[model samples]
Target: MTNRGRRIGRVGGGLPGIDRLFAALLARIDRGLAAGSIEVTLPGGGQRRLGGRAPGPGAVVDLRSWRALYRLATGGSAGWYEAWAAGEWASPDPVALFELFVANRHSLGDTARARFWSRLGRRLAHLARRNNPQKARENIAYHYDLGNDFYATWLDASMTYSSAMFEPGDTLEMGQAAKLAAILKRTNTQPAERILEIGCGWGSFAMLASGRGRRVHGVTLSAEQKRHVDAMALPGVDVTLTDYRALDGRYDAVVSIEMVEAVGREYWPAYLATIARVLKPGGRAAIQFIAFDPALFEAYARNVDFIQTYVFPGGLLIHEPEFRTIAERHGLRWEERYGFGPDYAETLRQWRERFDAADAEGRLPVDLDDGFRDLWRYYLMYCEGGFRGGGIDVVQVTLVKEG
Candidate 1:
């Protein structure tokens, strides 16, 4: 029999009442492991044999604390009964632990989740101390400056690092190209017209626009991407390693793809105003982004920590209505909007494949491989589930400056 089944056998047969209790515990573990690996470690009260490795004393303690809190949150251990009976794992407070597990939505399989929680808790703790501008800059340089080549491995050719779902029966490349083309079409680009691209990653859109005989200027905070863009020097493309707030020129069209999220909640109005200032009156701008379900954010604050700390530092996602209101308040009128729910799932899957391919080819930093893989897997899968659950959505809004 399989290890899991063997474990299950220990508890399945009718036995003396005392023996039945032991069997029941094993049964729970079996059930928990049956669907997949049990990511969360068991509570301190349960058998330690099934518990995964604790990084150190702190992780174990934190988990134990969380377990207690979780049990209280979940109204007791009733939820874990089936798992205890299945012989996979056991927890004294199953309900609370399960509640916390699903709520975070970061854990993928068994091993990954445990490692993530441990590492994530550490990062959050680090953020609590020494989290001034210097540290923020250092963190950004470490993560975002991984080179355009590195990001290009997983990101779309345009390096639009937001949610993109594949339209029905569309490949990653096809859907992405369609999405980009859709953005260009919405902005009504014309030859010889000037366009500004905020947060340009590898300058793909700028290069493409230049190729089409339009003047395209792009801005980004990443010096790494700036170097790559400068090296390419495709005609009609101008790339700047600069901040959006520093931009001064007015353009016929402006596009900010997956960038606004970096504007923290307090800066939303100001950020929109800045965009309005640089956009010519009557000119259209495409603002494409991933937005959180506002209701979800209202429900919890810490739930967004993963995106803020790991993916985009100081980022805040808003609901479409809030975003539109902010833009309208800045004297911009929304012209068109589109949402791609499935496209992002397909995009993330492609990113995973490419990242894996690069890893297998020994192209990535050895020290970063495990973490990147774990991070990407969690990112991709959670996004897929989010899309599946409609917990999140992507939006492409075409806004024109009021005349």
Candidate 2:
């Protein structure tokens, strides 16, 4: 093991005594897992099985050291990731492990969540990265500004970043095109109508809508995405580096794809107000959003997860009931909601395959190193598992402004 691995293994200090504590922690986790199972290989060549009461996805995990449990007990998902990065544990299929955990989250309760001090520290850190105007730009840039070339290597030609609406026998590109068409249809706008796209990613929707003779305007915080969109220069399509709150001018219809998740729970009202404010009376807004199960939202919100920690700093999954209530408060009627969690799982799977291919074929950007690739891979797997377990979902909804 490397020096870092050795250090992680020594996290709780005293070896023989710590082993008993870690074993007790494992016992608690085993009792909580009502569905699915994990076969854990212990550090001292012993094997233990957890959660076989009900049949579900099964996983095999090799605990290389007791520190892996310590990290999981205190750090929650983020600490588990640290242990993985430091070689404290290994899994033949990490996705299954993640799926199992998410599937049994209710039964597990706080078994795998961050402890008091860790939760407080992470919550404070997340608060510091709140999505105010200035901080919002920084947060968006943190993820979306990772070079357009890097995303291009793995994303479909449309360059759409949100969940794709998949059909039978559809490729990723076909699914993405279908998603764009569905969102556009929800707008119910006629040709020559003006359309506004919030968080426009690479101008995919703008290009698609403008091709049909509609004037489309896109707003984004990522300079890289804006540059890419501007370079396209599709006729009737215009893009600017603008925050959603700063957007002005009324449009016939509005569309925001999976952008609300980054707004944070505190800013949800502001996001809906923007949508309601910009849409012409009787205009419809099509929004694609990812939401967490209501049962898990409180726990998820209390502590930062792996995605919030490493990928998107201030990100929060929507609590559907609360968000819908906010939309109603803004005089926006939320209607025609459609959810396809399995499709998102498939989408992530395809993206991971493409990313792996890009890495293997030397198509990824030269600046990205091994650690980044690993992190990206884990992100994809984690999201895929979350969707597969049905704890997280992707949905498209139409909100009609009160006329």
Candidate 3:
């Protein structure tokens, strides 16, 4: 194994008789700093370490220098803080540093770069058992509960906040609408038929389907989303703040958009089972989800925490194949599969454009600078890259409950 790999494996594992690996790692970093091969010096003072454990004084960093240290500490085979002390890639604006990071995201290592992420996954799994509902609610609140007004400034009239479906040979708007229509078609909507939506965001699909004369029951983990959706509810729709597993009855069709990732791998089986349980035999349900390319699992696992910290908590981009396999395991058959990879790219572009234009208009909120803006920009552009590079895919999967 490579030295980086060995270090990661050792740290990830029990660390063989508790040999004080952190100390050894720290010593190695100290040595590297002394040898000058690792580089350690702070220039300007616009930066400080995130965790309290980072070094101090004379250890200050300029923006450019700090970024280089972050890259080295997080990317290389060793020295988390030592590398930051080097401060080689500093920039004047924090956003520039992030843009550089976003542009070169693929340069990060699989295990070492996302060391904080792996721990989070394990912690989530553990917490899921004890206070699943609270954790679920918090996760939802952290992401979707931000505020409807903020979302409204960019989303479609239907308030569909998930990835839009863009198809080849179609304009962005046409493709997105077509994607939604395609999912509706996949659900085989029948007038007056009962439908269930898991993790419903702002009730766009429910509203659309209800307009088609269907009775839609939408459940969401986010109370804010539920409240917003409920406020817009009409005669044929009901919006509830609830978990997918807690829904009481079966329906003619089920649909979930961009909600599965929060369910986590540990709960995938149960999640699928719940869907199957609520779906009537011969009924059709469509799921549109965020998925990473299967080959990129290692990178995803490592980097997922970055997203959790800055983008979506308890969020994941599962592989379409894995979802398919899980569906098969649950006796659910795939009826049709269409990918919305590029559509997401267009959607992000749209959102970025809207945000930039709005911000330029001096109408944007103050809390949107520095980290928040960086987070949103990274959220959009990296997602675009994920789709464009085929590192990620948004899939609309139509399925039927086996007889």
Candidate 4:
């Protein structure tokens, strides 16, 4: 019967009240913000204040269900994210909230406890979700195969699924086009070279590269993506629905856009070897991916969160140095590294806004159902939060095989 616990209506512990949970959660949050505000409204409509900071430029959160508080209390960030997706909570300023979270990410308590049971629990969750080839395909189909028509409602004209380069004075369409051009330029798609693109989404970059005076073969596991690519029926662009390891023939250049994240850590050696093995002598390869910083890579890699549970299963982001080291071991020298993290944050913002607007207006080409929509919402925003908080970075790396 601690005084603080009793004050929070936690007498004898039937189930922790909102006050006790809120107070505990706020203690963690207090370490992160530089005097910010989060005015919380409990499930039964009672209100509580976490900080003394006022509300004009702050965030308001409504815990619509008891599950929200319970999960967030027990699960930390992963749990909070689940509650958000489950519609257990609402925030007026999600981006700002994300910023605050990220600003203190280094201090936040997402880390699994040092105890054996806690570490074991995390490892088990990760082990269960590791992306083997079959599991990889399942995960790919889970997110990418969600209907081309569904994505058509919000994606830019290019229909590029990866992050776009949002340059100054550029529209979303222009940003996507610029990203494609940047990839092609990095790979030096000139002199009628034969090119291989791993994980081509909707053939946006592949089709564009084909017209760049190069023969492009795009490989993907998503039937929907292959169908969209095939429907274009463009010459010099050969699109196939198959795994990258199954593909044949060497190429003068290779380009992959943010596809490595889905490759899974267990397949990193094979993935790097594939690109290194297939490239002609002196060929250049452009591989873009989202990566965790080296210092935080091990910690981040150890856990599976909301993204792993509902979105990209078997998806893992490696460290930058890990990419360079692995590629170098496979006989590829890293020549350039391009950071597009901010651009990715912006790109996600645009996609989410479009999706939100379309859902509001009932203008979606097809019904996504509420759960699916919320899943996408969490996926996009979570990644955006990762980028904004400097927890991750987006990169297009250039590697060269020695002649």
TM-scores, all candidates, are: 0.68, 0.95, 0.73, 0.88
lDDT of each: 0.59, 0.90, 0.62, 0.76
Residue-level error in angstroms, candidate 4, position 260: 0.5
Stronger candidate by TM-score (2 vs 3):
2
- Which ten-residue region of model 1 has the weakest summed lDDT? 53-62
- Best model number under TM-score: 2
Please say which candidate is ahead in TM-score: 1 or 2. Answer: 2
lDDT per residue for candidate 3 within 299-361, as digits (tens), equals 555443445545666766686677789888887999777776767767877877777676677
Candidate 3 segments whose C-alpha is farther than 4 A from its true place: 1-63, 75-112, 115-131, 167-173, 302-304, 366-370
Q: Per-residue CA lDDT of candidate 1, range 228-262, in tens?
A: 88988878888886666668878999988887766
Give one digit per residue, the lDDT tens place, for model 4 in 280-384. Answer: 988999988988867756766765656765677777887778778889999998987889889998999899999899889887756568887876777777778
Query: What pairs collide in candidate 4?
Result: none
lDDT over C-alpha atoms for residue 53 of model 1: 27
Total colliding residue pairs, candidate 3: 8
The candidate with the higher TM-score, 3 or 4, is 4
Residue-level error in angstroms, candidate 3, position 92: 12
Q: How many collisions between residues are there in candidate 2?
A: 0
Worst 10-residue stretch by lDDT in candidate 4? 3-12
